[model samples]
Target: MCSTKPIGILDSGFGGLTVVGEVIRQLPQENILYVGDNARCPYGSRPPEEVRKFLFEIIDFLVAQEVKMIIIACNTATAAGLEEARQRYSVPVIGVIVPGSRAAISATKSGRIGVIGTENTINSDAYRRELHRINPRLTVTNRACKPFVRLVEEDLTDTEEARRTVTAYLQPIQTERIDTLILGCTHYPLLAPVIAEVMGEGVALINSAEETAREASTVLSVSQQLHDQNPQPQYKFYTTGDTEYFRQIGGRWLHRDIEVASVALGG
Candidate 1:
């Protein structure tokens, strides 16, 4: 399928739009369909089996939309469901982990990398595996920051509570002598300043959303799926939970009006 068919991206919540926006910026002529499982978000907090089940339903929904490609924009979903989704679909299915992992490795200065993601992502050891797979001698340090998701969803990324919580949770990883830190979750990028402040000026923060978007562009190019259309491509957003909240937060993040259509997902 060509890019005219629309690329599908799924996130546990509003975070996936970070990746969607990047893709649109890079591939201006491409259409995109984004699905946010807001009804069952914080997949990071759920059991692995539950995450997998939710992802399957979402994947089926996207595939039925006749999307040409699928991006598992949620790190927890990628760790728990990417492989299964890839095998089950005929389209080119991609996940954020490998692309992000490779970018982290390439961006590191001392071969020491720190990763901060959701609990399930860290627990799955997905990033560590890919980082080490690329360079066996690389040092990887990971921490699971659970409350950050809530902080982001509640629009409290820069609040005092978030500040204290982030600082306390990340204090140990700061002194680990790591030069590169991967924001494994898209939601984490919203806290980049606080993270940079806590980790100091020297640590380079690699955003997986940006890297993952680049990967999608490369894949479409290689597969001859890149759309050659001239007209502006439209983006459709859907949420299984609160459409107004999703639109408000998503518009704030994307710096544009995001009209979210109601969806029934994860049943």
Candidate 2:
């Protein structure tokens, strides 16, 4: 594999920009090709089969771009399709669940962990299973904040309504006395302040954005596929929804101007 080939990242929508932000921070030399299925934005409410199908469609698009590796940045898509994507693709495939699960397991002092994500991710039980796989005695509780994605997409993250919504969603999880909480969805990190306030200072919130980026770095290093010598790296963005909207949110998250183009997937 060529070290200079770009890494492909896919998400259900703008949420993946969270991962992109971290990747840009951690792997500055690497080129990134990101695609947001914003047209089908919240994959949380969809069926597993449908989500898997959509994931593969995006993966095909990424592969066509000649990406060196693929990162499935959506927790719901990672749950529904990570294993299958790994099996199908020749390139390295990384997902958020394992890194997030590992971080939660490593951070907890009480051995009790809480996870908040979309309904699909919570229902899939991916985080719980991954956490248990790492440490069987660890306890995991999950809450599905199905509306959090919408709050992020609509740019309502810092508003009073967001705080109220976050408080309402986190009330039960806080009662669990968990020492560590995993923001299982990529979008949830944007609401970290509200979540932290609701959960209090005792709980350590796990944002897998950085951890996932580290994992990707490790994978690239192990495969000897890192673009360490590349002084000028390219970053490209594509969306299935509105290009300008993706560009706006993505730019805000990445702290750089983004130009996004639309992608139409076949039926």
Candidate 3:
């Protein structure tokens, strides 16, 4: 496999830009090809079968593009399709759940952890299962913050309504007295400030984006696929929704002006 091939990343929507940002910061030499299924933005509320189908559509597209590896940046999609993706694809397939679970486990001193993600992710119990598979004595509590994805998609993270929604949704988790919390959804990290405020100083906030990026770097290094020669790495963005909206939100999140091409995936 050519090490110069871009790393492929897919998300339900713009939330995956969070992971893209980390990849850019950590692996400056590698090019990136990102696809956001913004037309079907909130995969969180969708059925597992539907999410899995959508994920494969994007993955197939990425595979066709001949990416060096594929990163499933959406928690719902990861929970629904990561295993099958690994089985189906020849290139490396990485998911956000395990990295986030491992980070939460490492950060928690009290053996109590909280996870906040989309409805599908929470219901899948992916995080809890991964955490307990490693340490069965750990206490894992999770909540489905379905609305948070919308807050990020609409670029409303700093608004009063975002704060209220975050606070209300987190009230139960707050009561758990967890010393660490995993922002299980890639989108949740964009609202980290508000989450940190709600959870207070004692609780550590785990941003899976960082951990996932690190894992990608390690995988590529071990496979001897790191792109060391490219200084001016390229970034390509594609969306299945409004190109203008994706460019607007994605550029803002990534802090760089980006060009987005529109794509349609058949059912």
Candidate 4:
């Protein structure tokens, strides 16, 4: 893969823009190509095998676009297919779980960390496993917030419904008295305000997007794949669903105009 080729990112839907934003902030010279499988979104509820299939489809599409690296920006997809993806693809494949777990580990003061994600992710026990792998002493509390993804996707993150939903979904984790919480799903970061309100000021919320972007930077730098010359890097977006909706949600979330094209995956 060429160093100047765009770095590819994919998610179940628009949630991956959080990672895209962070990458842009930290690695301004690098180009980005984002794909949101909006058609098969909320991979959190899907069977592991189905999620894995969709992930490979997206990865194949990204690789054809000649991305130098790939970021599985969806927690469900990451949990489902990260290892297989790394083995299947030549470029470095990074997932949100490990980075999120590491960030939660570093941010927690009480060693009690709470994690929230989609059903598939929480059920996969990926975060719990990664956290224990790093520090076996940690007390991990996990909750699957299924409705949270819909709230963010619908751009209802700051609504009253969003606040009530956040409160209900996070209350279980709140009782655990965790000093740090991992927004295990990339979509969850958009709901950070309501989540922070419900969890109160004591818990530090770890957005895996930021950590994942940093990891991508390290991988590129160490491999001499960093694109050093282009200050005006281009960004391309594709969706396996509604292009118009993708453009709208993506533009709103990223605070920039997004031109999206539709793609067909799993052919």
Pairs with backbone N, CA or C atoms under 3 Å apart (clashes), candidate 1 = none
Between candidates 2 and 3, the one scoring higher on lDDT is 3
What local distance difference test score does each model get? 0.88, 0.89, 0.91, 0.90
lDDT of 2 at 240: 90
- What is residue 55's positional error in candidate 1, in angstroms? 1.4
Candidate 1 TM-score versus the reference? 0.92
| Higher-ranked by TM-score: 1 or 3 | 3
Q: What is the descending lDDT order?
A: 3, 4, 2, 1
- Candidate 2 residues lying further than 4 Å off, grouped into runs, are none
How badly does each model clash, as a count of residue pairs? 0, 0, 0, 0
**Per-residue lDDT of candidate 4, residues 33-150 (tens digit):** 9999988877767788999999998898999999999999888788889999988988999999999999898898899999998877888899999999999999999999989878
- Under the 3 Å rule for N, CA and C atoms, how many clashes does model 1 have? 0
lDDT string, candidate 3, 10-124, tens digits? 9988778899999999999999999999898778778889999999999999989999999999888898889998999899999999998888888889999998887777888
* Per-residue lDDT over 41-96 for candidate 1, one digit per residue giving the tens place of the 0 to 100 score: 77877887899899888888988999999999989889988888878889999999
Q: List the residue pairs that clash in candidate 3.
A: none
C-alpha-based local distance difference test score of model 4: 0.90
For candidate 2, the lDDT comes to 0.89
RMSD, each candidate, Å? Answer: 2.0, 1.7, 1.8, 1.9
lDDT of 3 at 48: 86
